[model samples]
Target: MTDSAAEARPPSIDSSRPHPARRYNYWLGGKDHFAADRESGDQIAAVMPSIRTAALANRAFLGRAARHIALQGVRQFLDIGTGIPAPGNTHEIVQAVDPRARIVYVDNDPLVLTHARALMSGTPGTITYLDADLRDPAAILDHKDLHALLDLTEPVGLLLVAVLHFVRDDEDPDGVVATLLDRLPAGSWVAASHATWEHTPAEVVAELQKSNRDGRFVPRDGDRFRALFDSRVQIAEPGVVSVADWHNDDPGRAPAADVMCNALVGRKR
Candidate 1:
């Protein structure tokens, strides 16, 4: 294949084992998932039933948080671990408030890159797709494509939606978060949704651990999850509550802790 032909070809995705991005795509009912993702998702769901609700709530939190930031005059976004985009996407929510808002999506998933248009095709501002891993903050921070659409000097909304659990402790996730946050200027924002077993039943936690080893999502408990945020940022209201409870005005949803996922926002100082 010619170099140009290879560049035009869809990104190569590993279908042998379930990946977190693909499996998460499956949970969101998107079409980019593979059979391995489907099978692994079902297996995990069978063991831990709340996974579906957790996923939905996670997405809801992203929407609300994006709107919150956009209203605060944030016009640039660095959305990482941007799984197969489905609904209420970061750009969609942000652009509705300020059409000139720029968004840069970063993800290691080749499938997400292949299907990156879900986050692209904005009306006013620009959108760029980066085939990079969050594990390497240096690469993402210095990426040429992302820098074009985002201004490090200006406040940008850093979206860590449903990501971060993938960073094992040996990788120093806290340090990674700090590095990313430090690069952005003051008045920047960060919104994150993380998978946790804080209040999950002990039996469910055991099963989820097995699934994490076999599948994709890395489940953390409360303390470990919150440690990923840097101390420089001031946390937003509603604190580290579950996605369902973060700024919740509804009465029907389960209590935040009951869902076992924590969602929160912080502003750079």
Candidate 2:
């Protein structure tokens, strides 16, 4: 965990509470989760049986989007709300296309910072991790390490995968996204996937809403999800579809109705 001199002490991990990243890891069948995380995951799974499938599909979308952006000649990436190091990480996918690609992963989780070495290892490209929260976009953009590694004047691939739902409407999620995107140069790409209940059954949606009364998760509709990009970018083809169907050519892929997540990739104008 490389920390800037100005960085404060990393936040302590609260095993008692459920974190989005850990719960996500549990859904992805990873072992770096706590009992509270499993309990939250099981509760959600009980209502949405296809949640695990949605999680997998969202991860696949991240890979596809990263590779797609990299192939387009963007060599710098800023992946915010980065969960625990998983397979097909943004660095792994993009650096494969260009060894010199630079990546900065930002996450508030102290546990994710502990796994920073794993995320940086085995890749020739420049990779660094920052202990920051999505709610404070300025902290991420102002981090010395971020400026040290990435040339923000050049085109970048901004990744906000499966993490926006953790932010409630009152927190100004749209503003948070805008702040990050506004800092990037023109021609930069942004790929984001957010949880949604648009395609879900009413009964299941009601149950999900009740289960999420604690306000840990917020599922938006398609319109709300699409509005995250604002007028600064142009959404790519097959816009605002399920993560499973985003640029995926699998013959037997799950239907968009089955996956309760919306994904999109856009280029800055």
Candidate 3:
């Protein structure tokens, strides 16, 4: 059995060890992390220079996907692994298209939970926050707060942007995606931006991974990452391309060099 004391103490955050989400937040120019996250962010950036650009691209892709789905008339959103809020949050983007959009943001971070509640309150209508981890999809799905706010019988957009990279391979990532996607109805969509290193040379990926002590995440090759969508959903056009290559507003901006991630949008059949 897990030690209750260890679970209770929750470790003083060490402020030295690198955390992926916090580091990414730092890269995105968010002011919600400590010195350690900045240090780790710098370390990763030094090795993989496109880290910052990739983060920006990931955020942009989320906005584009939201707009695309909203235009298609899917108004309900189940945003798991919802990170710190910035411009173009799901509800804000969708509500612009249809004001009655219902959004539920889920995250395990206490800090994110606080920010989410603020974001929801500031938004126009029907917004909920569920303090749940992506690893615990069952707890997230079972959260009464969401069912009360969102309708499962209707098409819901499952947003997993830039978050699945935190789930290590041994955690059965494919199974995790399947479980979440399986629960939603026929027309629900699952969209994500996952970290990848295919464009980056192997040496760079190796150095960055080694520098983080393998903490950034398990680098899933294109094939393995695509396996997460297997047999469950119909991937949208331009399937699983580098974030810069996916439907972009500016093509002149050179494709983010050696992108460490890829953007994907899929619809459940």
Q: Is candidate 2 or candidate 3 better by lDDT?
A: 2
lDDT (Cα, tens digit) per residue for candidate 3, span 11-32: 5434445456567688898876
How do the residues 26-124 of candidate 1 rate in per-residue lDDT, one tens digit apiece? 777776666778888999889867677778888888999999999899989999988777878788899899878888888887878766754465443
Per-model lDDT: 0.80, 0.87, 0.78
> How well does candidate 1 score on lDDT at residue 1?
16
| Candidate 1: segments with Cα more than 4 A from true spot | 1-11, 117-125, 214-217
Superior candidate under TM-score, 2 versus 3: 2
Tell me how far the alpha carbon of residue 206 in candidate 1 is from the true structure, in angstroms, after superposition.
Answer: 1.3
Global CA lDDT of candidate 3, please?
0.78
TM-score of candidate 2 relative to the true fold: 0.93
Task: Give the candidate number with the greatest TM-score.
Answer: 2
* TM-score for each predicted model, relative to the true structure: 0.91, 0.93, 0.90
Model 2 residue 84 CA deviation (Å) reads 0.5
> 1 or 2, which is superior by lDDT?
2
